[model samples]
Target: MIYADNAATTKISDKAFEKMLPFLQEQYGNASSQYSLGIKAKRAVEQARKQVAEAIGAQPAEITFTSGGSEANNWVLQGVTKLFKGEDIHIITSSIEHHSVLNVCRALETENIKVTYLQVNKNGLVLVDDVISAVKPNTKFVSIMLANNEIGTIQPIAEIGKYLHGKGILFHTDAVQAVGHIPVDINKLHVDFLSASAHKFNGAKGTGFLYKSASVDLPNLVFGGKQEHGYRAGTENVAGIVAAGYAIEENVKEMRKTAERLQAMVQTTVSEIRERIPDVWINGNAELRLPGTVNLGFNGVSGESLMNILDLKGVCVSTSSACNSGNDEPSHVLLALGVSEEQAKSAIRISYGKYNTIEEAEYVASAICDAYSKIKSAI
Candidate 1:
């Protein structure tokens, strides 16, 4: 099968799996326990923490393990708001953010926190100028995704970070889709908080981390035993955490080469598909997108229908975020980019991974074109 839905989730790498296996077997011990077995688990978790921190150019103390990106996003958004309770604080976030961030903002609004849902351009980019203009004196925080999950457009984070730095507003980025795929540095991004998921980068699922700048302080999202340095409290997912570290380390080592290869495959597929389907248009700034990800709008076609047809042919793709898989609503991300509902509904995302080959890319292009032609003829 040609799996083009890396944006949704990736298959766990062999190396990561290998690193995780022992913890699930004989190494089963709670990280918080005081015994030698537990001490070993604790050491493993700490080593994972360091690996994650090093990957993002953060201090080990800054990384807090979480269930996944959603939790990390929730903690940062809600936890930070708790710090300024009863104050007129505003948050600036782009409308194209994953529902994790957008929904949390909505929840905050019920508590009377002001949130400015910043608009993006047609290319799905959050302009730094728009962010600057939206900031109020009461704007205490800004939450934006480093890269969009649907269109894979990288945001102008560094520039926005530079501006927010001068204003002393705390910034958080949901870097779930960007971390292992591209270079990420806490210092470079100048973010106070960052969220990432291991599954997006070929590590085990149900494992992720949050990077909290040493200078920032936020309330606890979970209340339980002392875990995550009293910031996030719960028993750690030892095996998943170990895998995450090894997977991230391995991916970073081979990132440049893998990205180059995937980009070539993506280009080949897009070119071939577009050659046969003239109305096909990419949804974001094509030049500034993730290396192997593309959201294509096929005029006069139902994205769901195309996705189902592709599935039947063993070419896996997605109509939108996997989180909203069953929801019939038009994509919020596309709507935020000013796309008509009809156009938004007609989009499909293709995300290639390091495992995909050029041959599979060519096959997927032919399959898509053939399916499109068949669907068009039926009309």
Candidate 2:
């Protein structure tokens, strides 16, 4: 398959898989047990934590393992919201955030916490000034994604985080789509918390982490025996965590070389699409987007129809977030960027990864143009 859905998830790397095998077989042990095997497991977990921390320029103690990005986001949103009871709490977040943040904000509303959904520009960016204007005396926290999943619009998270510092308020970023794909320095961003998923960067599924600063105290989302320094509790997935560390280390080390190739492919694809197809709109900030994510709106064609055709052609792409797949509704992110529902429904997202080749990109782009032509002709 000429897979172009890297934004949805990535396949595990050979190195990560090989490292995981030993943990799952002979090295398997309960991290909480008091034995040699358990001690080995505990050491693996700590090493993974350190690797993850180094990847993001954070302290190892700040990293807390979780199921994935979703849980980490929920933990921060719910845990922080619960901190202030019988008092006014306001959260400022972008309208184009991943469902992890949006859904949690919806639940926060029912708990008497006020949430302000900041609007994005046509390029799907939240302005720093808007964030400042949205903050009020009751505004207790701010949560926004480092980069959008579907459109790949990189947010001005560092600016927002820096501004919100020393105001007695907390800042968190859902960096699931941005972490390994680009350079992420938690200290530089000035964020109180950051969330990331392993699978997005070619690690095993069902594994991820959260970075919480020492100053930002939060209630535990999972209740059980002490693990993750009592911040998160459960039997740690030693194998998955070990694989994550290896994957992230590899991804970060080779990011620049990989990014250059992907960017070249993206340019070729976009130039081809525009030259061959008519009236197609490129979503998100062109210059500020992720390496190989292309969200294109074909005026006279349906995205779902194009996706089905692509799948039949052995090419994999997506309309939006995998979490919101099958919903059949226009993307909330596109709508936030002032795209009409009809236009939003006609957009497709194509994301590339390390495994994708220039030849695959050319073929995918050609196939899309062919599909669009057929769909437009019929319409």
Candidate 3:
């Protein structure tokens, strides 16, 4: 099968898998134990932490491992609410954030926390000016995603981060789709917290980390024995952590070449599909998005129908975020971009990965074009 939905999840890399084997078997020791085997596990976790920190230009002390991006995101958003118990708090976030961020903000609203859901332009970009305009005296924090999962639009986190930093308002970014696929520097983004996941970047699933700047302090979400610098509690997934470290390091080393190749494949796919279907148009910013992701609006065609057609042809694609796939509602991100529900229902995302070849790109494109034609003709 030609897999084109890397944005949802990526196949684990060989390097990461190889490094993780020993930890799952012979090196199976609780990182908290003081014995030699436990100490060895603990050291491996620390090494992984350092690797993750170095990749993102952060201090080792700032990284906190979690179950995945969702947990990391929840930790920061919910944890920050504790810092201002009695006082009124306001948060500013884009309307296009992952459900993890949006849902948490919604829950906080019940507790009288004010939230501003900033609107994105037609291209799925949150203007820095809009962020500034939305700020108020009670604005305690802001959470914006670095790259969108469905459309892959990279936000102006650095610009927004700079403004928030000057105002002393806490800033956090959900970088689950951006981290490993692109360059991320905490110091450069000026964000107090960042979230990432292993599965999105070719590591084992169920492992991820949150980057909290050492200058900032927040309460713990999980309570138990100390595991992550006493900030998070639980028995660490040593194998997954080890795999994530090696996966990210290896991806970074070959990032330049990988990006170039994926970009070329993206261009080829888009051009091929457009050649066959002239009315088809891209849904997000053509150039400012991630190298490997493109959300295409198929006009009158139903995205779910097209997706199923492609799947039957041995090609995989997605109509929206994997988390929201089964829901009958149209995409919230596309709706935020001013797209009508009809248009939003016709959009499908094609995301590439390093392992995909030029041949696979062409095949996927052909499959999409063929699927689109068949679906359109039936109507």
Candidate No. with top lDDT = 3
Estimate, for each residue in 273-374, the C-alpha lDDT of model 1 and write its tens digit.
Answer: 978997899998898989989999999988999999999999999999999999999999888888899999999999999899999999999999988888
lDDT of 2 by residue, 132-192 (tens): 9999999999998999999999999989988999676799999999988999999899999
Which candidate would rank higher by lDDT, 2 or 3?
3
- Candidate 3 residue pairs in backbone clash: none
- For residues 1-379, write the lDDT of model 3, one tens digit per residue: 8899999999999999999999999999999999999999999999999999999999999999999999999999999999988998999999999999999999999999999999999999999999999999999999999999999999999999999999999999999999998999998999999999999999999999999999989998788888898888899999999999999998888888999999999999999998989888888899999989999998889999999999999998999999998999999999998989999999999999989999999999899999888987898
Q: What Cα-based lDDT does every candidate model obtain?
A: 0.93, 0.92, 0.94
Model 1 worst lDDT run, 10 consecutive residues: 216-225
User: How many clashing residue pairs are found in candidate 1?
Assistant: 0
Model 3, TM vs. native: 0.99
By descending TM-score, how would the candidates be arranged? 3, 1, 2
